[model samples]
Target: MRFAKQKRHRKTIKRFCACFGFREPFKVLCDGTFVHHLVANHLADTTVSNTLGAPVQLFTTRCVIEELKSLGSSHAKSFRASCRDYKLARCDHEEKESALNCIIKIIGDNNPDHFFVATQDIDLREKCRKIPGVPVLYGLRNALFLEKLSKFQDEYLKAAEDERSRMTDSEFKLLHKRLKNTHGLKDLSTAKNGSDDEDLLLQSPVNRPLRKMDTKDTVQFKRKKAKGPNPLSCKKKKSTSNSGPNVRKTDETGNDAKRSRSRKRKRTHTAKTSNDGATN
Candidate 1:
């Protein structure tokens, strides 16, 4: 009985391991929202647990855990309970700082085999792309794509069902009209029909003005003048006079001599007074 139970347990573990591609175990670095979502919906938790299987670790930052806790008591309780079954790791200040530093260092590191960074933040994505080997996986892009696929699937299924349903002639006409007037479908169909007339109209000279391309010389004419002195230089003649030749001068040398004589007399008187005072 013990041997049979052991064999069954081994088989279960093997199956669980196989489900995750039998590669290096995935460490899910998720935000608090993911935890709350899993806990709020039992089916979601089951799906995630099944997909990840055993050996998958849950890594979250303290900030994320706090966010999950803030969701409500029930969500916090449920999340806490779910976390007990897995390898749960919390990112401390040091760890977060380390992660940020790693991101900064890896940018331009050019290691081809380096692990890619995953982030939803546009700023972070931009920062990561600056590094050579670090590729950023934008979560919003994947989310948007998944949402579009889901919407498409729903629309397709509804259309299929509508086609199958037995309807009155009026209802069928309305359905056909709705499908014909669908937002992108009409444009897509128009494109698929190879009708180049609309395209030609769009491209026609009447619709789109023919922009005259400027020659290199014409472009140079429009450019701002260079800051430096022109290579074809002109010499500026030096003016010998204090004032320009156009200006009238009053008593040019006489006023200068009178001022100099006055200054010399004033200096001689001051010196005589000082000498007399010194003698006294």
Candidate 2:
């Protein structure tokens, strides 16, 4: 059961990373409420990293730290001791404001810095949900979990996907070129010499009249030409005698000499031996 829950949390983190370009060592902005929860529950700061299954950098704004200081000595000491290593985020307020307001103002509508908000405040979490590209994290008892994508975030993802599926920049440029050629419109960059071309360039592209495109303007494929036989696959032709009848006769004679008509008998010295035996 725990494994399944961990898998689901990791999947949610992956979605945020894919959509909002979250990088390694994720930045988690900790609020005063979240710090208080950690201190009260005796939870180690590593719980955030363990929950997300990634390296994480904890950050707290000056306002949040100021709010933590007002919670009394015991809470302040323990919280500061535990999170002493956390990086302080600059909130840029001359006087300290409420932690909620400070965080909301920094995040704005889009969460451009790609921060994962770690907070126990219900209001803060709800506000984060409405903004696109902000992943929220909260704790239940000892277990920490990343929140699922809200409706706004999901819609933003869908819109981005749709935009990607449309034509690319190169394709749009090619289309513009084809349209200009089909309408016989001179390119605006080269229209400096002609008064009419300059006037036409002043008008919007949509205001131009649509006419039937010429056949020449359409793309034409090259016709395939006849090809010669493959030299490697062809048999070599016989060479003919070019000199005259003498060269032909010589060639014929050479052919006749090369041809074997019949088998020849081996010469024997048996007659000489028989005469010598008779004489002996």
Candidate 3:
């Protein structure tokens, strides 16, 4: 295959694998038309696996083999022989049904089995596009192509991804569990007449357990109270000595000595007497 075509096919396979949970050893379900195309084109059936670039297990339902058998063409023998090597997927049809109907029933609304549909039937291809997680493969001449996701498939993938993004795995599990319990409660309410189990589940707070608050959990603010005056702003008191009496006495004696020194002597009389004695 050309590099561009291979790359495109690879990308389409990857998108299907990522979005639809396709795993290794892909299971491809083939119908009679596709098998006939392979035989008519003289292509090796392994060409499909090779183009896919992955280990593949081809599958066909009993109805497809029956349909090919009914054709009665010599090419139809080759188609049946081509399908002979494929693994049979049980349609379990007690009566014969069309190959398209068999494939559709197997795929259902969503392909939980992760089937890659190989077909040349336009109707089947159109139907596969509408169902999410079904990747269709078709061949032109010698080249095989994996079809890109249809609009419906893309929209389904986007919606599923959006839902998954909005909810985590744990949330999904919890939601499932809650639903189970709700259903159980509803059943119990119906069995016991006049029981309010469902009503309580919907409206009462008792449905959910209350968390107990610890004493330490209570928020306590530090209250503002009256405090002593600021020590920095107060006047300093004089530090008194232990000998208070002796200090007072010493202060009084110092005051007396100062008064005696400050008193005036009889200097005037003494100076006049000395002058008269010298003159006589």
Candidate 4:
């Protein structure tokens, strides 16, 4: 804890020369331990004090909520009540990350909202300090002390002035000369001595786009055309229902079907009579 405090002080001095904490509302992240500490001291009213450059807003992660629930019934209830004042941020790695690890990951990520870890844990504080631009906040005697950090990309900054001064007078030539034989320049005449307007019209029947021929589709269509009619398909079966004086007109096929069913019965075996009797 002492080491974390000393290191925080040193970094805060460096921050004076570095990042300006112009964050409209500096977001302070609280862990389970921080939440418990805040609740125990009845410090919810003072959690968002104006000691920092901008107004402060308290926030906690889902992992912190899980951690609070694991603490027990009473503490969980208190944490739940305290949470109404702070926004709960959904944690991406709930199963894999601890509260401290999750917090470190959230703040250490590139171009994240400026956050200050409001906790009393020495290990967590020390861990957060290693990341580029994170601040540590601790409560002392009902007041909060914020340890600010400012880290910049020294090498990534472009040396524009030096580049401007390095350009010599001898290298004044422009790149990429215009070519006379290029497509747009060479084609000045729109008149051509070839096909007529009708041939060029894509909408004409002769110029219609050809369909992509597929053997499978053509073969399937031919097979479907050649297939026998389904016997189960409903045929307009005409029954000989007498409709009061006017019989419904029947087609030739129906007549033919009736004729086939009423074919003359074959003679019941010609009497092998007289010959049979003599033979017997």
Go through the candidates in order and give the clash count of each.
3, 0, 0, 0
Residue by residue across 199-253, what tens digits does model 3's lDDT show? 4334323233233446698787989999999988797887976563333333554
**Candidate lDDT (C-alpha), each:** 0.42, 0.78, 0.78, 0.59
Model 3 poorest ten-residue lDDT run: 203-212
Cα-lDDT of candidate 2: 0.78
Tens-place lDDT per residue, model 1, 1-280, is 5455445544533532342123334344444444444544443433433433334444444444555556687676645854564333433245434334433443335423233343344555555554433323323211210011123334544554454443445544554466456434555346554354344333432343223344853545456866987655856766776555445445855553222222344344443464565652
lDDT of 4 by residue, 46-123 (tens): 544544534667888877777777778868755675467778765666375678888887776432776767888889
lDDT of model 1, residue 180:
50
User: Between 1 and 2, whose lDDT is larger?
Assistant: 2
Model 1's number of clashes is 3
Q: For model 1, what is the error of residue 165's alpha carbon versus the real structure, in angstroms, after optimal superposition?
A: 60
What does candidate 2's lDDT look like per residue over 1-280, in tens digits?
Answer: 8899899998998888887888888899988888777777878988989988989999888888777788788677545753586788778778879989999888888887778899999999999999988899998887787889999889989977765655555645565676567656666555444456445444454443344456898889999999999987797777974654333233554554233345799887754564565752
Error of 4 at 165 (Å): 14
Q: By summed lDDT, which 10 consecutive residues of candidate 2 come out lowest?
A: 244-253
Q: Which ranges of candidate 4 are over 4 A from the true structure? A: 1-22, 94-96, 109-111, 148-280
**True-vs-predicted CA distance for residue 8, candidate 2, Å:** 0.7
TM-scores, each model vs. reference: 0.26, 0.62, 0.59, 0.46
Best by lDDT: 3
Please give the ranking of all candidate structures by lDDT, highest first, separated by commas: 3, 2, 4, 1
